[model samples]
Structure formats: C-alpha cells, structure tokens
Target: MKPLNIFYAEPDADRWFKYDRYPRRLIRRIFRGPQRPGGVMMVAINLMKGLDRLNIPYRFNDYRYINKHPEELACIIGKPQVLFNREWKNPVLFGAGVFSHPIDHAKLFEQYPNLVKILVAGEWMRDMFEPYYGDKVQAWPVGIDTLHWAPQAIEKTHDFLIYDKTRWINEGLPQPFIEPLLQTLNKRGLSYRIIRYGSYNSDELKQKLHTSKAAIFLCEHETQGLAYQQMLATNTPVLAWDKGGYWLDPEYYPHRVQYSPVSSTSYWDARCGLKFSGHDDFEATLDTFMQNLHNYTPRDFILDDLTLEKCALKYVDIVKSISE
Candidate 1:
C-alpha cells in the first residue's frame, strides 16, 4: 500500500480580495452559501473520491511531504500557478484542466519540459496539444461516481431535459439554436424542461434527469462533459449537438489554430443516444432518437469505462508509469 503525492489548488487564496478574506468571506458563506466549484475543481474532487473508494493512500496538497520525497511522482491536478512559482524535482503527472491552450502557455510547457505526462480530457484535445508538446501529451478523463448518478425509481414527467451550455456569445442576443429547438418541441407537442448551464446546481439537474425520459445537450464542445456523462450514468439517453468540425474557441480558431473534428460529447457511443449537427438536422434526429430511446443503455457504457474504482486504478497506473 504505497502512498501517492497529489497537489491541487484553485481559486487560489493569495488572489482573494479584502472582501473575500476572513470575516467577510465567513459572512458571505453564512448568508449566500459557499460558491459552487467549477469543472476543474470537480476533476480533483472526483479523483480523490475514486482513490478513497479503492482505499489507496495519497497525500493531498502536502507540499512539505513532496519536498521531502523529490524522487516520488507528484500528480498536480489544477491551476497552473501552483506549479509556476517553483521548479519541482519529482516526476509529475499533470492532469485535468491545467491550460486552455498550448499557445497561451508555451513558456510554462518549456519550463516543465520533463513533466511525465500532460493530460487532457479527450483525444481531440490531445490532438490540439500534440503538435507543440509531442509525446508528452495524453488523454485521460476522470471517472464519474456511478452511485451518486444512478437512475432513480421515479415517474418520467417530461420527454426531454434541455441542458443548454452553448458558450459562444452573440453580443446582446438570445441563443440562436435554442429558440428554434423550443419552437419545434412546442410544435411537436412534447413535454420538456430547460436548464441553463451555470444557472442550475447539480441537485436540480439530477432531479430533472430522474424525471425526464431523455436529455438534449446543447454545447459547442466538451473537453470532457461531466454533466452530460452524469446524465448518462443516471440511465438517461442524450440527444447531443455534436457539430463536429474545427475547434471554434474564439481565442484560437480560424486565424490562430485550426484543430478539426471536435465533439460536443467527447466520450460517447451508440448506446449513449443520438447526435444532431444543428437546427437543420435536429428535427429528424430527435424523431429518430425518441423512436429508439428505449433501446439506449447509457449506464452500461459508464460501468464499462468510467466507474469510480476503475478510473482510480487507471490514475494509479498513470502515476506509476512516470519515471523516478
């Protein structure tokens, strides 16, 4: 039972303002509740939970322990700033949402050229980074907690749960894709519930999934769509907007970088459900998807590839692979 060194930090405390400090922060927490953690934070949280399930020994954010054992592998799952200030002696397994793009952090990559592995969520993301980082880049998605996301014994009150995470802003305009979809759903006399990405919490979404027959995921792309995966883990089929083409991040698209064949659902299979490109194909796809909805066994896919213990073991293997 060897121990593993893991480091993670986000919403870095040093960057907190006066209002975000001590008494004020405490008051805010009391009145407003603690702020919900974003995707990157969840990645670290889920990994630790997975490790715990396997009874794996691991030290979290224990920098002193890391300093003492420089020859050990240090898995840094987090904000790049944690690694920026100092040169690490340990072989590192850097995972999860560390960098948005390689162009933005060329110097960071250069500084830590010996990083055992630079992990992204999917193969498409790996392709985007491979040109710059070469063989050092690998795709490694975190596991989902199947027990938490399991199907509930509830009556399905709605036909679809519309999960809108379309991030591209149209400059003071409503989302282009959603309105039309809503209209079509109305015309078809379908019962559905709409939940915007940042507006709703996980519990609310979980309830919606339990009540809905299926989910409609409207996102441009996902490095690894945790929410959508959760929906699948709950045995809910998804009608995803998988407009596969060049990466469309405004920061690095046509002019800067043109990585192709990007997907809205990074980890998907036939068992998960259907995919439609946009308004054009959506109606037809929806009809077909609904017609064959009963056949989908999305939870099976999760059990096979992404159970908590399974992914934790994979992470252990990844860490062990790093050279001392």
Candidate 2:
C-alpha cells in the first residue's frame, strides 16, 4: 500500500491565546489543558483516526518529507494558506473548508496547477461546486466515531431534546421556528430540554442524548451534520427541520449565486426519523414521528455506511483514483 501525505494547517497554534514566551505557554497548558477543536479541525482529526484504525500508512503535515518524495499523493485538508509559500509537486485533494466557495479563490487553480480534485462534504455541496470545477469536485463525509457515541444503558428521561442550530437571521428570528415546537411539546405535556449549538460540548451532548427519547434538530442546512449523526449513532431518532428550497446562505444567495434542493441532514433515510418543512407541517409531522418512534433503527443506518473503517476505505479509494 502506498503511503498518503495529509496536511491540515488550521485551528492554528495561537487559536486560544498568544503564548509568546515559555512561561505563558506553560501556564496555558497547566490551566486550560488543550483547546477544543472546531468543526474543520474535527474533520481532519476524525479522518486521521479512521486511517489509524485501518492501519493505513500516512504522513501528516510533514512538508519536509513531502518535499523529498514529490511523487506521492498529497491531501491538503484545510486552510489554503498552507500552500502559499510551499511548492507541492504532487497531485492534491483540496477542500473541507479550504475556501468559503470556489469563486472566493478564483485564481487558486492557476496558482496551484497540481490540485487535481476538489472535496466537498456531500452531494448537495458537490452540485454547488460542479459548474465551476466540473468533474474534479467530489463529495466525501468524515465518519463518526460510533463507539464513543453509542447508546448508553441509562434511562431515558426527556421526550425530546431540541438542538438549535438555525443560522439565517435575516430570514427571521429563531422564535418563529422554535416557539411553535415548544408549544407543541408543552401542550402534549412532554418533558424536553433545549441545547443551542456552540454552547455545549460533546460530553454534554452525549449525556443529553442518553436521557432523551428523540431529538428535534433545528438547522437551516448542513454540508454534513455530524451532531445529528452522533444522535443517530446513539439510537436517538431526530425530527429534523429540512426546509428544502434555494441555498439561502446570506453570503451567496439571491444576490451572488442561486442554488436549490439543499438539506439539513445530507446522509439520512426513512429509518433515521422524520422531517418537517416549517410550522404549518411541523405539528402533523411531530405527532407522526412520536407515533413511529419505535420503528426507527438509526444505529443500523450508521453501521451500514458511515462507520470509521468503511469511510476510511472510501477515502483510500478516492486517493487511489486521483493517483492513478
């Protein structure tokens, strides 16, 4: 098996605080432990873990080694500036938030002619990028760590765990979406808990999932929603807000670009749970979801396609395709 060269230069060394001197750095390490990884950093982290579990040979962020062996396939997973002053002589798989969009870095292709492939998290993202980059764009999602996110033996306490991650402020306030759901839960006399995105950590979420019978995922759309998938891995079904329409990202919607048929959960099926477009349909859908909760086998879906080893093997295949 050929060794892969992977590079990720994000969540920079000075992300938490400036450790200009040894004393400050020591204090930070002693007090704060380590800074928690953000979304992009987690993608790189999980991919490496998957590779490790598969026992696949790979070099991580070894520029000097890569320079010596220029013939090997190199993957730049994030942060475009990693290639600014460096000269990589091999074909590269570039994306996972390398840029906000292809148009943002219009000259990148000309600058780095060796970037043979563009990586996006899902088919919808690939669709958005396909026009600009053609067949070079590929969809690949990082696998969830199912072992750590498995169902716990604890008793389920709450009927619902509302996950709030809605990001479009101009479309209107979150109250329009959330208030109705809360009312429904209240009227039914169901116990529930609300967890806003970015306000909680993984350990906190895992505990909540263990105690909750189901989840109400409130998100505009997802490239690949790892949190909801984590919920699925725990056998906690989700009632997702999948208001399918034009890609309404304020940065690139209506004015700059227009795309359609986006999703909240990119890799989902009927077995996962239910979906509601908005307030009009949410009530009906929620009732149906509650009635059919016992029929959902979400964990089986995760085990089938999104396991660490399975996704690692898929990644290996992508690397091999580009190399050949």
- lDDT scores of the candidates, listed in order: 0.86, 0.85
- lDDT of each residue in 90-184, candidate 2, tens digit only: 77788665665677766666888998888888999898888888888899988889899899889999998999998783365655668877988
Best candidate (score: lDDT): 1
Give candidate 2 misplaced runs (Cα > 4 Å): 11-33, 169-176
Residue range with the least summed lDDT across 10 consecutive positions in model 2: 11-20
Model 1 stretches with alpha carbons more than 4 Å out = 13-28, 107-109, 169-175
Q: What is the lDDT of residue 60 in candidate 1?
A: 93
Question: For residues 1-324, could you state the per-residue lDDT of candidate 1 as single tens digits?
Answer: 468888888643523565455676677789979878788888888999999999999999999988998878888897777676668988777877678889887665667865778889888899888888889888888999999999999999999999999887343666676888999999999999999988988899999999999999999899999999999999999999988887878888878888888888899899999999988998999899989999999999999998888888988887777752
